[model samples]
Target: MKTDDLISMLAAGNPAPPRAPSARRFALALFCGLLGALLLMACLFGVRKDLAEVAATPLFWAKVALPAALVLGALWASGRLARPGVAVGARWAAIGVPVALVWGASLVLLAALPAGDRLAQVLGTTWRTCPLNIALLSVPAFIAVLWAIRGLAPTRLRLAGAAGGLLAGALATLVYCLHCPEMAVPFWGVWYVLGMALPTFAGWLLGPRWLRW
Candidate 1:
């Protein structure tokens, strides 16, 4: 074949190279996940001693599962949005906001109810610590989780972040539970949710801008 013809054929057969995944981005996500977990655990320990013990329980595993489900759901949503050329910032907000609201509201309502109700006892214990613990640990936790998600390769970031939040929250909550003695479903439903959701929301809002490569 003529040289010109051969060049055209080669160009047609070989498509553009795929973009490489960013190592820096993945590192950022991992760092955020680890740091957030550490900070959250520290807050829980500072407020209540019993929480340290609770952190070791099987029940704690169950609690973490709930958030993991939420995270996976969010990741799936992110993937769908990406296909349509959605901005990363917008996609994070679009998916993160609703999850945070629902999670937060559920926690508030659960906490507001009377703990003496029979149903509350069967789930787990709730010990009241200063709200300050929530403020310190949960808020940061959310930020880290969001940062971790942002670092994920576009295809997996959303879902992975969500799952990471759930796992992190569950671990944090387990620690919180060690010190709490309320043992009511509603109480935990509320306070634990707040602890997990607040930080996640913060991360969602801040991570895109701060962690972006």
Candidate 2:
């Protein structure tokens, strides 16, 4: 057969059925996971005693907003990964911008403080427990996001897992803020990010096994 005629014949065959998209499933699972995390946080660690009054301040809002931003970015990337043949593109960098801005502001905040107090600022009262708490809280969301991914087709397993981990971590942090009294950005920059990193690393390590098609 002529090359052109052979190609045409091959192209004329019936196409395979398309799979349903997983974005909606991912969203619903994520919502349920977050709801469970919130309930857990509420029961285990009640909202900060001063939350009602503090809720009115910018500092309290900033704490909530930072992790919320991460949740949005991570979930967006995770949902993208749920589909095969999709490229993450430059959008990943945009996710880090908010964190960078917060880090920059944190540096400024540190610079303004006296040298003696700088260390204390970064190591807030919960220095030992903060990251652990954040990591522990992320478990529910991580499992939920993973369940979401398992039902879809993802070519980039590691990246998808990391994004799932991030979504879980961010949501967990959002809940953590309600009970955490620390307002220092440097503390968040270090411990909060580390807390998130734990799951991200776990996902990266376990992705190949769990996310395999």
Candidate 3:
């Protein structure tokens, strides 16, 4: 058969179906991960006793917002990275902006306090466990988000993996807020970020192996 005839036959009645939007896949993945995190948190430490009271407080939402913002930014970055040949561009800035804001707030808060009080604010009662808990909670989400990314077309495995991992960490950190008692900005600026970083760095390290298409 002629080339034109062959091409026409190949393009005939079996039209390709539309693919699901990446946002929907990511949303489902994130929701699953959040559920897993919630279940894990409930079993491991349970939500804080005064959660209802704290929920009414502005500081509580502020704490929740930090990771929520990172989640939004990382979602944008990860979605771009999951597609082949896509430039991450300004989308990546979404991740850093929240960290910068928290760090800035932390610095101002620390500077305003007396030196002795500053250390306590930064260290909080749960300083040692905060990051560990956040990282631990991120495990489920990390698995979920990476699974979602892997099912798609991610060209830059390392970057895509890192973005996915950050998304997981930010999401888990958001859930962590429900259980975490510490509300100090300094504590969040330091430990909460560190918790999220653990998974992001892990993704970078494992990207080649884990995210390989």
- TM for every model, in the order presented, reads 0.44, 0.89, 0.89
Whole-model lDDT, model 3: 0.85
Candidate 2, backbone clash total: 0
Give the count of colliding residue pairs in each prediction.
16, 0, 0
User: Which ranges in model 1 have alpha carbons more than 4 Å from their true place?
Assistant: 1-31, 43-60, 71-132, 139-141, 148-182, 200-213
| Model 2 lDDT tens row, 1-213 | 133543454477612112344656777778888888888888888889998998999988888888889988888888777666566787796569868878998899999999999999999999999888988888888898987875665668998888888888888999999899999999988888888888888888777888886
lDDT for model 1, please: 0.46
The weakest ten consecutive residues by lDDT in model 3 span 13-22
Ranking by TM-score: 3, 2, 1
Ranking 2 against 3 by lDDT, winner? 3
Candidate 3 TM-score to native? 0.89
lDDT of each: 0.46, 0.82, 0.85
RMSD of each: 9.6, 6.0, 5.4
What candidate 3 gets wrong by more than 4 Å, as runs, is 1-21
Candidate 3 residue-wise lDDT, 1-213, digit = tens = 133543453477422112365667788889899999999999998989999999999999999999999999998888878765568887767888889999999999999998879999999999899888988999999998988777665668999888888998999999999899998999999999999999999888888788775
What TM-score does model 1 achieve against the real structure?
A: 0.44
Query: How high a TM-score does candidate 2 get?
Result: 0.89
